[model samples]
Target: MDELSVKCLLHANDQVILVPSACGLQEMVNKMNDFVKKKSVKVYVGKTKVMVFERGESTTECDLIIENEKVEQVKEFIYLCSRLQIIANMAEISKKRMNADNKVNGA
Candidate 1:
């Protein structure tokens, strides 16, 4: 996915709990919370206020702004997420890649 899509995924705050497939959702949540708590950063998932740390405070706005000025950083984050997804689904991806390679090579 592109940077915007990745950002959207990170910023979504719907009540519906999406069961993450291969990615560690709990770890992501914990890291996100820790980022806010440690950095004292404000974060918001749309209009819904997100409480980063249970014992800390809530983030009404995003301190880590995703603007055009930070395009490189955003791209890096997106690349990292993509790499994580690939690592998480390595077996499936390997199979697909092998199949495609075989087809291309007429094997």
Candidate 2:
């Protein structure tokens, strides 16, 4: 059996974990809960959120728990200044010209 590794990103005091499957994702969450308790650190559960990026047709369902509490799942979340939108909520905006050329062309 091959040992699967959890892919994680650490930036300052923030941590981001990405797993291939829902099961793996849940396992990682559980591990994190244990780690925080052992280190005697506080986890801002209310500020924590979980998001699964997948195709529009595919529904990726996973329950993420922190400190025995379920974390909020959001379709679109703003990270830094950019907004992370899901496929279902993705849209395109087009801007039309407000005014046409004032001067008429001399033929």
Candidate 3:
């Protein structure tokens, strides 16, 4: 997936942004900042963080730094109401789902 879409969904008083990183993290952030500037919206930097999804790669070199603080990387994230992993693995997701179901059923 190219993931080259500008997502801007407004809900009540909050908005969501889903920027694709076809280039790199820094480039994506720059692109997002440029986009925000064009739209004349202020980005709440304190509330913003980066979630990197990659497999079999060292992320030590990836510095998703905004301002002076480095954005934290998360393994799993909840978007909307569903739990989504950054890396796409159908089997893993299915297994995790089954485990959750079993735990619930067992209880």
Candidate 4:
């Protein structure tokens, strides 16, 4: 989805959470409750690091940098990047969980 849609969704959903990518959300999963999950999205423009993270399944963090871009444009980019990360992370976790479940069942 686009940035505005993503932001709207985040504001609307109580289950979604956001955290800054610099906060090391990946290393803090154990402290999270069972209802929460980890999500991360990274943006690289020829090696620059621009990343966003959603942690604890209830927050949405927006970190949009405006260098050559306008304020509104940067805001959208930030929202989109963060939302993408959340989706990607969720998919990854789901896949891993499925694989683990399969292994246990097949074993």
Candidates in order have lDDT scores of 0.37, 0.67, 0.61, 0.38
> TM-score per candidate, in order?
0.23, 0.68, 0.53, 0.23
Candidate 2 segments whose C-alpha is farther than 4 A from its true place: 89-107
RMSD of 2: 7.4
Query: Could you tell me the C-alpha RMSD of candidate 3 in Å?
Result: 4.8
Error of 1 at 84 (Å): 26
Please write out the lDDT profile of model 3 over residues 1-107, one tens digit for every residue: 14555557566535555655425556667666777778887666666645555664425344576655676655655555666565466776799889999999999
Candidate 3 global lDDT: 0.61
| Predicted candidate 4 versus true structure: per-residue lDDT over 1-107, tens digit per residue | 11212221344222233443434433332233222333433222233223343454534443333233321211123343463334445677799789999999999
Q: Sort the predicted structures by lDDT, highest score first.
A: 2, 3, 4, 1
Winner of 1 and 3 under TM-score: 3
Q: What C-alpha lDDT, on a 0 to 100 scale, does residue 92 get in candidate 1?
A: 61
- How many backbone clashes are present in model 1? 0
Once fitted onto the true fold, the runs of candidate 3 whose alpha carbons sit more than 4 angstroms away are: 1-23, 56-61, 86-95, 104-107
Q: Candidate 2 has what TM-score?
A: 0.68
Candidate of highest TM-score: 2
Better of 2 and 4 by lDDT: 2
- Report the lDDT of model 2 for residue 34: 77
The candidate maximizing lDDT is 2
Q: How would you encode candidate 1's per-residue C-alpha lDDT over 1-107 as one tens digit per residue? A: 21111233443433322332313433444455566668876434333322222222322232322211221111111222342121224576689799999999995
